[model samples]
Target: MIGAGMGAMAAAARLAVAGRRVTVYERTETHGGALRRHERDGFGFDTGPGLLHLPAVWRDLFVKTGREPLEERVAMAQVEPAVRHVFADGSSVALPGGSRAGTVEALDAALGPGAGERWSELLVRAREVWDATRRPLLEEPLTGAVDRAALGRDPYPARRRGLLRRRPATLTGVARAELRDPRLVALLESHALAHGLDPRRAPASAVVLAYLEHTFGTWYVRGGMRALADAVYERCLERGVEFRFGTAVSRVVVEGGRAVGVELADGTREAADAVVWGAGGPVPAAGDAGEAGGGTGAAAGRLTVLLALRGRRPEGTAHRTVVHTAGPGGTTRTVTVLRPGDPALVPDGEHESAVLSVAVPPHRAGAGRPADRAEAMDWTAGEWAAVDWTAPGAAERCADEALAVADAAGLGLGGRLLWREVRTPADTERETGAPGGAVPAPVLAGADGAFLRAANRTATAGLYRVGGWAHPGGGTAHAGMSGAMAAGLIVEGDDWRGSR
Candidate 1:
């Protein structure tokens, strides 16, 4: 394995159990690619993903590798009232999880009558899309022989209203056609935006994202998300997977057009029968040189602010709250407030630790090196770079913005803030080696196939890509799926359909 990201470790555990002497080389000193934690005093914060949706992916990993189930390894709790959506129209809805009827009721209560019905109707459509693409687009690996055309075909059906036959291909289009209300439109588009995708271009199939969250529900590890990664790492060790930390893979050693081993930065060479490339390691800093190259259209970056408050969390608070704003140009600006359900995250019973994440565009050409100089003057470009959270003093500005958004949603911190820490995409790049700290978006079904991800099987024999950057694309669950698909291909051969 090239890197010790979740996908790499998941695959390592499976391959080791298959009687292969699995060896994982991680560039970082610690395990868990983006699933990192930050601690100060007694407070803890999950820097990467706060919640795990569709945890069945990891559950399947544990079941296949050992007798112990996932629950045995990590304690997880379903987040009640899955999310609180605060829209620009001053209307808010607290949507319940796992129950379609419950969600409909909440929407009806908050957004007025018939609102719930319309939202529920949209979810029904989403379910169809999910059923159509789940097997081929997600469970199976994307190989040369696979029918990529089928994956590109949109499964969402067109809408019919009187004489109008509206066939909206994108999520934004669906929002405009079916959900005429701006708040409801924002609610729908927020799902796509949260994934670092532009809803205007994202396929209508993107509706499945909201469906999956509401259906499977959101879950959080007891201690932190890092605990989930630790569980996977422990599972790998139990299967006898060897791991080398603080080691950089200079290159994948190729002989006869096949990867036979890897060359480390220290001039050490380790041979292997097959190579799994998990690009979770850190990339080069600023002008520093590195083996990894930069790529365009990497998923948008996240700006996170960790708040250490002096007050305790009030009772009946939503686990997650989304504050939505619109820019002068009408683009949505979202800031997600995460109040971990676990009490262990705070320093004491009298205090609370909250995390705020805002999706920002990737610094594709780095600061000042514009991809299009004229585009910078455009509203989108300015809106994208409005918060360079990595810049000095920008953290304070973003924290203020988050607190303001929270306050507007009636989540007032008042003077309880003790301290704050900010993390930017640059910080992520340094940690995970993803250029500009870009977060990879999940692949979507679209007409031009512009959103398709790279195939797991590369041109080089014995070499494969696995992780958020590969087939099925980003998100904790998707990464786990990529690992499973890659491992399946190696263990079951190229003709492998998928894991049963």
Candidate 2:
């Protein structure tokens, strides 16, 4: 397969279960793609995606893989205040758990009277769309052909008469369809930003996002995320899947419009019935000379960061300082801070660092020489360059950010700093072949990009897709589900395609 990312792992497990002799090629020594882990001394850190929300996807995958049932590895925990929104106006409110009633109540209290009612109406409407598309889009078998299995269930629903009446459109459309609260609208639209997607461009069908998270609830893996990846890898070995870690696949061996095998960088060609592009493309680095060539292991100009922090995070808003450069004038820098989890990365709890990530500013697409002075001022880079967690400067940076949030949210960070770490975008991209160092695969929102993503069916035949890069979207939510659907397509045949 192409990359042994999350989607590729899911697909490989499913393919193996269906009795296919799958051969997966992963460039990294570990599995789990973004969910991979790293360590220094005794401190360990989860590289990407801490919160495991929308977990029905995993449950479903376990059934197909015939492993120790999803419940054995991960259990569902319903946490309240799904997230705490801190506003610069010093106005902050914690949104309750993913429930229609709970959300409305919280909105009403936080926003105003009748605000809850409006939020309820919007979600209720979204719930309907969720029902209509859940089985068809999320669960139903893949057709392996260009067909709308969803539209098949209702060929004559007669609801397509008007554009406004169609189901699963966009976030804005859904808000207009039911909600009047701008705050409520922003709350629902948060998912787009969470994935680094532009909401204005994402489709109304994206409304399904809010519905899915609310109804399904969020979860945390019982252990760290790596355990889950190891489980899947173990399953693959049982099913006889071979892998070549650290050995990059230079290119897909394509001929006569079919991908028969792959050629490793050292000039090794391995043939197979089909090759699944599970591994991500080449590493993204600054000034990558060969990146422009556009092939396997050649992608450049992007990066992701991972930080390992140890010691107890300040309690009750002890963590602070996640910001995004704003407006047309600001650079594209996103900084996120998360408290170490209850399950520490090390035997002693003093090993986890509050994780922070900053994407390396890309060189101007058509610029000459190196980045100019103006570009440097406008673009943002990783915070680690400026702050040292183990040094004296970390205290200043942490306190500065904490105080910023205090002024913004009216919430005080009461504890002293213990430990810290920072990751540059370039570091992540170089290690993992993620383009632009994008995580959770930058949500392919908006009309223009609706078709820009990689499809389950590539230009080649027999090859299939699964994982974060699949349709419906990314995250643990889509990865496991996409794998299941791809498996169904391979096993059931493509006779039912093109109906929609």
lDDT of each: 0.79, 0.52
Which residue pairs collide, candidate 1? 281-432, 282-433, 283-433
- Can you write out model 1's per-residue Cα lDDT over 227-263, one digit (the tens) per residue? 9999999999989999999999887787787778888
Candidate 1 Cα misplacement greater than 4 A, ranges: 161-166, 280-298, 364-366, 369-390
- Encode model 2's per-residue lDDT on 162-190: one tens digit a residue: 56546434555555445655555556555
Q: Alpha-carbon error at 418 in model 2, in Å?
A: 4.3
User: CA lDDT of 441 in candidate 2?
Assistant: 34
How does model 1 fare in lDDT? 0.79
The stretch of ten residues in a row with the least summed lDDT in candidate 1 is: 370-379
